[model samples]
Target chain A: MLSSTVENYLKSLFLLDPRGEKEVATGELAKSLEVTPGSATSMIKTLAQAGLVEHRPHYGVRLTSQGRTLAVHVVRRHRIVELFLVNVLGMDWSEVHEEAEQLEHVVSDEVITRMDDLLGHPSHDPHGDPIPSADGTLPTRTLQTLSFCNEGDNVSIARIGNQNTEFLKFAEDNGLLLGRTITIKNKNEIADSITITTHEKEVVLGLAAAGKIEVEHV
Target chain B: MLSSTVENYLKSLFLLDPRGEKEVATGELAKSLEVTPGSATSMIKTLAQAGLVEHRPHYGVRLTSQGRTLAVHVVRRHRIVELFLVNVLGMDWSEVHEEAEQLEHVVSDEVITRMDDLLGHPSHDPHGDPIPSADGTLPTRTLQTLSFCNEGDNVSIARIGNQNTEFLKFAEDNGLLLGRTITIKNKNEIADSITITTHEKEVVLGLAAAGKIEVEHV
Candidate 1:
């Protein structure tokens, strides 16, 4: 069995290069994992030796197909666990991510499958991130951020790009939840803020916050 | 945070000396943990230094009050996870022990508390083992095994003392479930077997199997 540390590394690599289209620099990997470059390089070498990754000297590293398979399973476990914590256990969506990180490595596949069944085989988690299928296939979709929506455009919240607790709490407080439809009231380029109407209430958000919220046209 | 190994040792000690009234031999601890006596002694010394156990060289060791509290919490996690797996996930009772063993080490306290509420604060798990309360209190009750019951005694299955998968599967096959009431129709001492009636069907079990089933008077 892979240690949680190894699983975390693989998952991070998958997230960094979701399409496996390019190699990720060791420095970037270290920064993402909050580990020293030396530690990341050492682990990358180990992964290379195990044929889970291909390391290019002075370039970076990319996961091998075998590594990608394992990484996607970890992602599947993580997203499924997050949804289970929120939907089944009634935990706040903002709080479930931290809990899911610890659970993803330890939860058995059987239990995860059962949870998936109980959840009616959901395609997306609470944060609107796509859940990898049981067979490790991840569905990809592109949505525009709220900041990019045109004035007077009606849209539905698709996903939250920023998952930080404070950001999620703020979004929740402002009623910016997944699948909630709202009209783009105005976009002030000079002020770098966007105004939107939800539940007959107009709310203004800074461009930075608006950019983190992905939305789909109604 | 205690490593899972440390938690396992502490939990083993608690199981071997539930009342914490007597010192347990290193050899016994080693046997229970399937580890060498040398390894057990090494860990015991470490635990002693941590003030979690009182160790006497050439004799045995026992948990301190502080150690007992931590041990009970691990037990609580294990039992709650087991019950959650069985009741919520719809897993077979005979198969959930191994899953719970891994999950108990990594699950967050908040998640476990939520699961406890979901399970309605169950006092006993699927196998009828008592679950430690959230505050580290364990309820103890004494009951007689079926082997000691007199012929014609009407009893309800309170707990299954044996947790082995094969034994539990056998019990389930014979409809010997928790809270199931059965009549002790006969005890053949010479044959070393006991005959019980459940659901108007007479089933015979070896004396050893009967000894592992704890029951209470109906």
Candidate 2:
């Protein structure tokens, strides 16, 4: 009977350490979840006691394999629901993330599977995030952020690292989307902005914005 | 900010008195929600304090207009989700009721409206229960339990009063579905059994089972 709050914690931990490589500092998790340091510590202790997380005194915490499984399932539900909301309901991709956050916790696994099948087993959600497989594995795709691409490089957008609705809307408005080919025209290091051409339209994106858009070299 | 448990309580209250009529006894609500009388009394007090319900000590409780509005919305979500699960997802009708119970509390109003439109504004769910309109009005249809119908009366199944999965499955298997016209064959009052003929098939239903099937004179 994991509450949605607990599920959110597990998902956040998985997102912070996708490969389960190392311990994630408490302060880092606190920042990620936007909770106070005190609250994060208490919650980490609770998770550790439940065997969902491993905690070290004065160090950091990491998810156990049991916790990872639950987190992946939550991610699976979220992506499937997001795709369903956008594809089936004709909702805007910008608005589906918040709706999926609430629904992912309550929709039965049966419903998620139905949605997955209905959407033809989509590998990516509307936001370009991989939908975890039913068996709890995520599809891997190597990509670099637009900010890291060299000037004059040609790349195809592979994913959007941010789920912020406003940012996503901005990206969509400027023709930044998964699979769109873009040619880096200029990189101004001091101004922290990069210039790119997509389908002959020149667009200038700030460092923050460019970093949020991951791309694969073409 | 009401929890799903609180929403369930409000929904139970609305079901106990859909018309917002006279006060509903605490014991009746307790029975409907399968909670103990003491718990029901405490919950009613909490609701009364929150102004969603008016509790008359030793008398009963009744929903305020604010509460009724919220409850109606919950009911609307429940029926819409149930219909969506069955019609769109091709899920079993017997299983959808339970799924809708959890979803009704969490699905966003936007999602519900999309479902309502996708379903082409269905008036009733698969179980033959009326779906409350968005503005909190229910379409009225007079109906009575099959147990109350006289022998030799011709009736059309209007709705199923009980949402029990096993009973609903049995009713479905026996062709006791909404809008199905059947002729009363015989009634054995002492044995508490009633016989009906639908199409060319004759079926005998127990008093309890018959009571759960609502019908209208054809």
Candidate 3:
């Protein structure tokens, strides 16, 4: 059985380049894991030895066919668990990520496959993150950021970049969730703030905050 | 946040002494974790620093009041997940344990408390293992072993020691689940196999095998 830490490394590596199907950098992995460069180096060596990660100095890390499959499976398990927690268990979307991270490593393939079937091949989790198919294929999507719109352009909040509770609560406090439509009203002359209209409510967000949200045209 | 490993240690300590009100032996904990005595010593020290365990030399380890509470909460999450898997997800008993172990450390207290309410305040898991109440109380049960019965004695299979897939499939093939009655017809002197009658069929099991099964008087 792979340890949760190793499973996380694999997932992070895959997430870095879902289709790069190529090598990834040690520095990028360290940033993702928030570990010391030395520690990431040591772990990558361990993972390489275990055949979960293939490292090439400047080229970065790549999941071998075996590693890629495992990463996909873990991602699939995580998304399914999130769906189970929210759609069935009534847990808040923000709370499911940590819970799913812990469960994805322990449940048997049998349980995960069963959960996938029970969830009816869901396309995305509560946060609007695409759930990879059992075979590692992600549904095609063309997502745009709320900040990518011009004044008076209307769009739907397709997803958010953050799943942290504080962040989701912040979004909720501002009336953001999947399928919530927002119209960009205007941007400040001197500052980066952008104003938006949604659900009969107005939200004033800075440029960085506006960029934190992803949206799709209505 | 407690690492699942630490939670497992606290859990093992608590299980060693049903009353968290007592001390546990280091050797006992080592045996439970299949770790060396030296490793247990090191880990117990770590746990103590984390305020999850208190060690009193040869008397072994005990949970701090805080640790005991955390252990109870972990166990409650575990059994509630087991119940959810069995009752809601229709997962087999054999598959719930490992999943519950992973889930226990990750799920929030609110989710578990809600599930406890949804499961009708179940007193036991599908395997007849006592489910700890929200108050950390184990319901009193007076279950006995099926093998203890003499010839012509009738009993219902209350639980079994093993829930591996092979065993579950074996039990299922023999039409045994909770509430299934087994009446001992006779004992073969040579093989020590007991002839038993079930709902609509009769079967024989070796003495050692039947001894592993727990039962309740009908």
Candidate 4:
């Protein structure tokens, strides 16, 4: 019966350091959660006492193995809920993230398992974000961003690093969907833009936007 | 957003006095919520200040129109979630209630609307409890319990007034499901039991259990 607050903290910790190789600074955690640094420190202390995290004072905080497991479960719930909202409820992918945020805390593992079964055990969500398996292991796929693609390189969309709603809508509008193939026509470092050809049309994207679009060699 | 605590209080109030004609005693409210009388009184005061209830000292409390509307919406969410769990997720009817209790608080109006649509706007939940409309109006159908039926009376199960999980499981085990037709075989007032025939089999039940099974004249 962990509070949603505790779950959010652990989830944020896991996201901030997916490999659990580095401690996240209290200030950075506070900024990510939109809470004051003092509040984050106090919560970190509590989590340390509960053995969910190790607080290294001025160094920062890192989740314990127990905390990481809980955090991965939360992430799994979020991704599953997002897919269910879009694939079953017919909701837009851009709007489901916010809905899934609230639901991930309240939904039961039983319901999540049922949803996963109903969805045919999808490996990825609607946004191409990899869904953690029932055992809490993420898919191990090395992907390169569109920005790093060389001219004439053929690639297919794999995942979207940026989950902003506006960015998702823009991706949908430009037909840059998961599994869609594209060819890098130009990469102008000076202009900070990358031009790609998809669906028989050329689309130009700034380097920042291109970097958010993860792709795999076709 | 109303905390789940506030929503629970409102929901309990509505269930205790569905017609909003009678005021529910503070002691009764406390027992229903499994909270102390002092805690229930304090929450009642908060609800009163918010114009959700009219509290009469030493008498009882009743919901204002605003409060009743909110309570009805919570009920709607609970029933819809219950049906979605049972119908869509293939969960057992007896197990969905606890899951719905947690979910009804966090689920958004948009998701509930989608579920309602997906369920084809079902009028009643799996347990035969009428679902409140989007406008917060409940269906007005008067039904009689099996205990009140005369010997040889023919009726069909309409709703199970008792929502206790064990009772529902017992009902299921005995084939006393909604829409099933039954014929009263005998009424033993001295023994406080009723005998009914269903599926060409005679079953005997205590008056209390019989009283919980609401039925409609066939």
Score residue B12 of candidate 2 by CA lDDT. 96
lDDT by residue (tens digit), candidate 1, A35-129: 99999999999999988999997799999999999999999999999999999999999999988988999998999999999999999999999
Candidate 1 regions off by >4 Å?
Answer: A186-192, A200-202, B188-191
Candidate 2 global CA lDDT score: 0.92
Q: What clash pairs does model 1 have?
A: none
Fnat values, candidates in order? 0.96, 0.87, 0.48, 0.83
Write the number of the candidate with greater TM-score, choosing between 1 and 2. Answer: 2
CA displacement after TM-score superposition, residue B190 of candidate 3 (Å): 8.0
* Better model by DockQ: candidate 2 vs candidate 3: 2
What is candidate 2's fraction of native contacts?
0.87
Can you give the TM-score per candidate against the true fold?
0.94, 0.96, 0.87, 0.96
What lDDT tens digits, residue by residue, belong to model 4 across residues B94-213? 888888998999888999999999999999998889999999989878899999999989999999887789988988888898999999999999999999989857889999999989
Q: After superposition, how far is residue A196 of candidate 3 from its true place, in Å?
A: 1.3
Give a tens-digit lDDT track for model 3, residues B1-218.
77878888888887677676667888889998788998899999999998888888877788988888878777778888898888877888877887787778877777787788778888888877777888777786777766667888889988776656677667778877888988889887577787888887888888777776788988
Q: Which candidate leads the pack in DockQ?
A: 1
The digit string of per-residue lDDT tens for model 4 on A63-175 reads 99999999999999999999999999999888899989999999989999999999999999988887999898998789999999999999999999877899999888888
lDDT of 2 at A157: 93
Lowest summed lDDT across 10 adjacent residues in model 3 chain B is found at: B161-170
lDDT of each: 0.93, 0.92, 0.82, 0.93
Against the hidden true structure, what lDDT does model 4 obtain?
0.93
Give candidate 2's total backbone clashes. Answer: 0
